[model samples]
Target chain A: MTSDLIAGTPAATGEGPQEMRSRSELTAKEVLREVGSVLRMSEKEASELTSSPVENDEEQTMIINMGPQHPSTHGVLRLMLELQGEKVLRCKPIIGYLHTGMEKQAEELSYMQGGTNVTRMDYVSPLNNELVFSLAVEKLLGIDGDIPERATWMRMLLSELNRMSSHLLFMATNGMDMGAVSMMIYGWREREEVLRFFQKVTGLRMNHNFIRPGGLAADLPAGWRDDVLTILEGLPPRLAEYDILMTNQPIWRERLQGVGVITAEEAVALGTSGPILRSTGVAWDLRRDLPYLKYKEVEFDVIVGSYGDSFDRYAIRLNEIRESMKIVYQILDKMPSGDYRIQDKKVTPPPRARIDESMEALIHHFKIFTEGFKVPEGEVYVGIESPRGEIGCYIVSDGSPKPYRLHMRAPSFVNIQALPHMMRDGLIADAVAVISSIDPVLGEVDR
Target chain B: MSDAVVDSPAPAEQLYGCVVTYSRGEKVIHASRGNYIATLKKAIDDSFTMCTDLTAVDFLIYASTNRQLPSDISGERFEIVLNLISLERRERLRLRVQIAEGEATLPTAFDLFPGTEAMEREVFDMFGIEFEGHPDPSRILMPEDWEGHPLRKDFSVGRIPVQFKGAPS
Candidate 1:
């Protein structure tokens, strides 16, 4: 019973998630103890507890700390929410819990080490972030993505797979937050399959660091194709199961529909991006509209909603999962193999053995490794379509190995700005719906 | 702040050994500061506005390389980058103008684009680049009592100023 409150389970299952066991092992005892301190008090109760009044319920306003520890807040983020009973009056989101100073830290690192730095920004869609940063740098160098047809396809394929995983995680957690018990079970199961695809291709489930400056880290492993195809093939039926279990369900509809509705003008003003912006009747998809990579070759639809409500956000995510899956299927069919890295060894390091044999290779490797290749001094902003929204990297190279300034316009960070606007004078329960609907990752927000 | 920019980066046809690169999600115009805005307007104006960015990068390297370094070097002076984001095109254009290290007087873009009000103030606070005509040109990020521009490449990133944070370093 205590664990259920701690995990926010609406109904009890025989066994908790297996990942929760691993989490218990990884987290420090102090962190777990701190979480326990909060689990002892209900968020609903805490909001009511803060009111300075007699035991009269109507006059008191409650202030609740909605995480930096709780599961549903997504990463280490705390929202100081003011509640007049169950309806939220105001919400002030406190950030910087995950302030790694990734931009400042990137300056200390050379160009080649950029992947290791930026891949952690959007931890869920690491490859997409890595790709955007790399492309911006490469563009500065006047280099194109001339690696291989297959590598580009692989980049697209993995991005779509990652999108599915990201959206599935959102679905699972959003469902759990809204008391849709079975949806969590189904969503997590589907997400696990996508993670398995990442594990096989990049050897890391979350942060692959596979996409690099010139090309991929290396060629895909043998039989990797089969593994991804299997997942893409299996996703549609599972997505349909989710629709039946959650989307079409009347109770799910009631909680989400017409809740926290934002207009297209409001979304633009607040800097909201991704599906949240699209849900507001805006058809601004970076892939179709902006056209990055081989996205021009691949065919897909930009899912838009008439109303920018929680329900529309949910619907867009589902439609995107299907669209992304469709693209993944096409990538598998059209993937052409020739070269993974650029033929110019100056831009890319040679095969591992070339360092031992070739003097030119040795010198090139040393210079590339240490001094790092210089980008011409100028600036270009490349807005790449991430699983979320416009993940753009505006790069200014002073013709140096390290970027002079590294700034990320993260979708989650900008989208989170809309939170207070949507939640003001709304139900306290609606705050969770608004946040979960935004699907923000604190890593990206505070980065 | 109000500024008059004569942005000229050589003759239009003479594309010299200039290699343009983008960095850190900020666009730096990497040309000589003489007539920099006039030239960028010719290049980026019709298709996209060369809106300056949150902060500017003073190419101390380029200034030194070209033997164009300012005589009176102060902590405040650096290059100003125009961070232009296109609403219609959904694109961005970065234009730059270098001011002397000590003297932060440069042409303001508010005359060209009105949305640059917040952006110019940010550059003033972060890099101490004074926009001559920027209305309400004051520190936006740091406190009024704060010393020196915070985002310059020369500005050290370590150590806390006790007076700023209410703690002794």
Candidate 2:
């Protein structure tokens, strides 16, 4: 029964995306298939066989495999490294182990179904993925400027909260990768608070498909204002404590400072973004630089650093968490009240009462479920200040329910390009430190 | 002049019949600056600091022109889009330029905005849109052997089947 059911399913049975995603959801058959793909290094073995070894040399280069399971990679990322003594002569990030084909999957689903696909791409910060995709689709639908102001503001609030939680995981994991296991305890504890806020709003912790095309799933519930305020109020003191515990520590400073530096030019050319790019003194936060939502009305600073190194990335992230805290505070102080999602029934389903009373409302609902709303023939690019960086989605709607072209400009994917440049000419010890600092969530990268 | 191509068409004549439209298909403003992305960028760059996003729209059925722009970047191309955002104004603008494929190669935003470096690479990666002087010209996303630009209108949605093992192996 299970095998037949799995066969009936679409791409979930595919031998990819198991790397970043938990394999528990997959049956034993699925895992075996993915493992086969992982070990299918046909080209590698052929190249290795053709190469001649140093017959009488005093030294030899060693090739190594680093994770799809290793901890330091942040997700199920595998690295092929050629080590000359302690120096890495070359490194290739073997991705697609977590290949969800999110962009492809999104094309099969309607615009309404798109949130489910996007939320899984950058699983850590699903709200961001949802927001950019929805905004782009809505732009294609020509309802972008028509969203209720309150929806836009709340979207910003939740997205900022998402950033805080994601960064806390980074804080925890970076600590663990560096052997500061105690810091992991602190990081998860802090991240849990942000997750609590997420749960209060969206009902799910990790993969909330709450933010959808046209607007959000539901309006801010009762006591959400108080809950958000409390979370915001509580963050600053913890940030200061984390600062003292991590940043000011002499050992932490040494482990991080001046390690894995990428210059501004190189970062841009290689597509490094988020804290990694800001660490080079760019001050180019998408919220400030390219205002979205009510971000223009809110007051915040673009956190920047002088050295584009691991220490700088670490510091910028810490400061950004605090900055996100400030934005949440502002949202509480000035959030407008109205319908959360747009009132456009063509894109958004009408109120439940209308569904019961009006035949047209029932028809709209059925059509939305079956055929989905058709976006006009056009293309749009919408980006947001994801914790990782400028998480943008470029959508092309060819008068179809499914997007013609759906490509995500995942910040983690772009930022990972700088890894080879930063990891070069550095000791093996710096590898973990450098990778941790970039805070790449490969769930997004492979998607 | 191998690298340079020019048409001596009268700028006034080209600008004569151009129309511009915005939200809900309303013409917010219209003015023609002949046929270069630079002209559009110049008209707006004074307000918008960043040429943040650039991509093309394949108006398969909607576009009046039956002639499709060639997917190749080196050839002259149109049916293109350039999105501009102003950090100061808190506004975003999208500029459209519909040119034939061989007439492609819109002016580079690399000079107007430094951030176009990666975006141009993405355009090249998916749509095969090339920036003539792009600093590094290599595939940004797909493997080297990947046959076609996935974002092109013609690429089909291919499927992959799955299988798995449960317990730790």
Candidate 3:
């Protein structure tokens, strides 16, 4: 009698509304086969199916691959997500598609040319990479104190600007990932202005290789002050527009708030840093804590988030741009006057004019360029507060022209570890939000 | 060499009996070869919660005879360098564990700081140093089918010559 009833009403087999609707939508042949299978099953099995339709349907978790080429991943970062219905059970971020072996290549390059290599690691924050590598080399050389005052201020200025540009990129990409299309346009517009200034100062849009072991590539170009001021003055209004567009928007709030929450304990355990670690309410900025470069002299607040949610991460990065601008303004006001590169003839090549007149200057230039400066046999780890986090360069110099082993403790690589913890038991959609909030660059991750 | 000597109290002094302290440039390094895992576990318990980096250096060619290592510590062909930081104390400590050329096994630090999981895998992939008890021990930055550890000093550059479309192969 029960089997006859099941055949008559195939969709009414004690399934939930969702399961029932899906069952009803199936083709006649599928329904017939399903009914036939149900009829052949025991009464106990039928009762179990009817009692817990949702559970029965979701018995098997679906494994879905997010990307190694997906646009939302920012670069070639593939995330294998195990999903049960709409929720993600586990996520594994598979990287190394963009592995350029930059660290291996750094061993072949001399210290003078090392800046150009490390700069390409975090392509967005090239200056920070160059700065950390140079600082490590300088520390090995035991000449950290001898770096000229003017050069220090210039590095500070350029780094802060680089931070602003990197954060701007985050704001734009984060907006696009969360479905705010206009932010893509607005974020790029402001970033383009910063890039224009970078071009004028460093002579490249990206991977400038301007910062060197001893000092900067050259002094700040003519009219650099006005160019910097123009960017500083131009950013606030656009930031206000961002606030209206994303910060106050209900949809944006709904998608981000209380989503991808990671506690301070989890963040630290996973070794996540930069904004991701800061978002967990840990107030542990390397700039403030370690006090590298001239960060000690400058006054800027470390923007920290309380809940450590995706929203907090977004808000922190947006507010950080304002803080970086503040630092840039301070650098501008206190711009020191002197040689941009160090005056040490062994480290720095002589001026173009000096090379023309003096045979000694020409010979010094040739030697420095060809043979390169040899660092003392030692290993030093220099960690700087990059826009991402603690971008450290661990260099082991064997008293050679080239580093024996150059290891970059890239923040992106560390921060990506937290993604599995963040995505665990969260909806598949939230996984996208969480990854976007992490703001990882695959170049650094794979390298 | 004198300037590299850290006057600060050595935190890992109690953990290992043979904890040799030396200065490498401006940084103070606490080095040990045997019982590497226990020393690292002690460091973690002593507020070195953050494992900033874990990398290995192959000193095949650059092993200078005038190396500044202490007399008690024997040098090896490969050395695993671990950088740890105590966030509360705001102090950084470096630990170097020397692994012999043929024997490349070191106990994992993943149980201490879960962050070292990927770093351990990277060390294994690049330098061929195996971390025992690692949750996922596999090639991180290289393909699984890769022949040799690329970062070893003995590993060749593995250069592939480039050819233009219309030019000779």
Global fold similarity of model 2 (TM-score): 0.73
Top model number, lDDT: 3
Best by TM-score: 3
Error of 2 at A50 (Å): 26
- Model 1 spans > 4 angstroms off: A1-65, B1-91, B94-169
Residues A1-447, candidate 2: write the lDDT tens digits.
244333433222121121122233434333332222112334354345432221222246555778869889987877666566887544556655675556656768888888888899888899999999888887778788999888888898889898899888888999899899988998999889889878888898878889888789998879998887777777778878888888899999999898888787666544456898799887778787767788889898888999898999988888888888888888888888888898887899988889999999999989998999988875567778898887878776668788866778778776775676677657678888988988988888778
Give TM-scores of chain A for all candidates: 0.84, 0.86, 0.87
**CAPRI quality band, candidate 1:** incorrect
Of the true interface contacts, each candidate retains a share of 0.05, 0.04, 0.33
Location of the lowest summed lDDT over 10 successive residues in candidate 3 chain A: A12-21
Higher-DockQ candidate among 2 and 3?
A: 3
TM-score of each: 0.74, 0.73, 0.87
DockQ of 2: 0.07
Off by over 4 Å in 2: A1-61, B1-169
Ranking by lDDT: 3, 2, 1
Instruction: Sort candidate 2 into its docking category.
Output: incorrect
